[model samples]
Target: MPTPIIIDCDPGHDDAIAILLALAHPGELDIRGITTVGGNQILDKITDNALKILSFVNADIPVAKGAAAPLLGKLVTGEEAHGESGMDGPALPASKFKPVEQGAVEFMLEIIRASEEKITLVPTAPLTNIALLITAYPEVKERIEKISLMGGGLAYGNVTRTAEFNIYVDPEAARIVFESGIPIVMSGLDVTDKAAIFEEEIQELKTRGPVSVMVGELLDFYSIYGKKMGFVGNALHDPCAIAWLLHPELFESEHLYVTVETEGKLTRGMTVADRRKKPDQPANTEVLLGVDREAFIKLLFDSLERLDRQLGSPAGES
Candidate 1:
């Protein structure tokens, strides 16, 4: 049987591709639901983007909207990176699918409680929803198999000198999750920055099929932000989380005690990974430190090609 999982995300351009990749591999992943939280944009916009991606893929997974802001801070969006419409570039039609009437926290609770097997969680946005779920229902912790999240950085930060965007957006939520003691696999910048999609690769993807073309367009727009920062291509951030689930061998990780800094003036949101193996700090996170870039990209391209074959022509092409 496929590994049952839930995807909690804010549909940034990369998040859109991650959804497609997850949906493409039904044989490998039985996606139970998609939950949206506020990060790349507001709750409404991100949720709408999630609906749009699911609609484009003709997927039937349930989506539920979660927190609009962090537990204790004002909502901050990465408009400069993702554009005004969190998922810019793709001339996507309006979403036809509707999210579940129940809130995201409730949806998570129901799914976990009802499932006979432990479910994996792939969180590609801020940790708000995951934190809320844990806080509201402490019993559900035992039901989670693992949390593969795209956030944090072991080295330099993307948002600030000491913080990554996702965790920085909601350090409090991240703290709650890190301290909850659930198994965690963090695909932080240490690995994601290496999962870069270059211009030539984008052009090649466009020829693969309609879905690939749409993904190429999304990456094209997403790459602009990275170029400005002197990067060769855009980092496939969210997809790295999913990729870890699909092919753990493609990544090299370290077991460490990771904690989120929610109260540091200069280091708020910084993921303090205890690499030194301090006696008091028990290892809490499997922090991905390296990735085989070639294998990672190949996995993405192959998955997209498979999706293209399965879904037929891209929407509006026929």
Candidate 2:
């Protein structure tokens, strides 16, 4: 049976690709729904972006709008990296699907309570919604199989000198989730930076088909931002989280006691991973530190090709 999962995201370019990758493999992952949170953009735009991406792939999954702001701070968006519209590359057609009236937290509780099997959560954006879900309904934690999230960094930070964007957007929420005692896989920048797709692979993806072309365009736009940050190509940050769930063999991780620094002025969102276990805190997260880049890129391309074949359109037109 496919592992049932829910994707909580902000629909940044990579988040869109992550959703596509998850949908492409129905046999491996059964996506219960997609929940949008405030990151990369505000709640309204990110939710709309999520709907449009799902529509592009002809998925009929449920979508729900989640928390509009963080638990304590004002919302911060990544328009500089993702563009003002959040997903700025491809001219996405208006979404045919509409989000359910139930809010993201409520929907998560409902699904977790109703499902017979444990559900895995892939969060590729700010963790406000997941934190809210846990805080509002603590019992749901037991039903969650694991949380594979894209945020934090052990080496360097993208937002601050020590914080990544998603976690930096809402450190308090991140702290709550990190301390929630649930199983977690942290696909931080340490590994994602290694999963970069350069110009050659981007061009190759464009030639695969319509869906691939769309992915290629998204990556192209994303790569420009990467270049500005001194990277040779775009790092598949959000997709790494989903990719790990699908192909754990392509990655390596270490168990560490990780905590979010919610009070530091300079490192508020920093993930303080106790690799040496000096704090004597019980290990709580599997912090990914390495990836087989060749295998990962191949799997990503193959998944996009499969989806293109299934959809049979460059823009998903039947």
Best by TM-score: 1
Kindly list the per-residue Cα lDDT of model 1 for residues 6-43, writing each as its tens digit.
99999999899899889878888999999999999989
lDDT of each: 0.91, 0.91
Indicate which candidate wins on lDDT: 1
Kindly report which residue pairs in candidate 1 clash with one another. Answer: none
Per-residue error at 262 for model 1, in Å? 1.1
Error of 2 at 32 (Å): 0.4
Question: How big is the positional error of residue 153 in model 1, measured in Å on the Cα after superposition?
Answer: 0.5
Q: Give the Å shift of residue 131 in candidate 1.
A: 0.6
TM-score of each: 0.97, 0.97
